[model samples]
Target: MVGIVIVSHSSKIAEGVKEVALQMAKNHPVYTAGGTADGGIGTDPVRIQEAIEAANTGDGVVVLADLGSAVMSVGLAKEMIDPALAKSVKLANAPLVEGAIAATVEASMGSPLAKVLQTAHDARNMDKVE
Candidate 1:
């Protein structure tokens, strides 16, 4: 199964999203990369990289970042990885909470990395008003 990583400037938000996503991905690896090393309201590349490494289970990791810095942090984390491992990590351009849920459900179904990434991306088209 493909793993999942949620990155957010706020630690609580990241952890909370992970918790919710875990409901669908009970058997999959779900990780959170949040806050700075000093407990500030910011993203940490180190933490993001660690989360990516921990979540990876050979299939690959789908990263859902909350905001600007969190997104950049994930990118920086990817840059820090070895070329081979970097290829296994994808920075998903999907909404954090919704994307995490969608990805987790897909991953739980034993879907491949590309399928999981597609499901998360599709969440962006969902219409809440319907």
Candidate 2:
């Protein structure tokens, strides 16, 4: 199954998203890289890269981040990871919570990397108020 990584400025947010996503992807790898190395409100390349490494299980990893710096951090983390592993990782441009849950569900269904990524992106169009 494709793994998932959640990157957020707040650890609580990342962990919360991970907790929810895990409910649907019980057997898949789901990791969180939130806050700075010192546990502040920022993103860390090292931390994100480590999360990516932990999430990787040969299938690949999809990363969802909150806001700008978190997104940039995931990008930097990708460059820091091993080249082969980096190739298998993708930084998804989707809402953090919804994307994580959607991606996790799709992944749990045995979908491929592309399909999982697409599912997460598709969540952006969901009508939550409807």
Write candidate 1's Cα lDDT for 7-126 as tens digits: 999999998998888876677689988898898889999899899898888899999999887877888999997779899898888999999999999988989999999999999998
Per-model TM-score versus the true fold: 0.96, 0.96
Residue-by-residue lDDT tens digits, candidate 2, 10-80: 99999999899888778778899989888899899999999999988899999999999888888898899
TM-score attained by model 2: 0.96
Backbone clash numbers for all candidates listed: 0, 0
Locate the minimum summed-lDDT window of 10 residues in model 2: 21-30
Residue 5 miss distance in model 2 (angstroms): 0.1
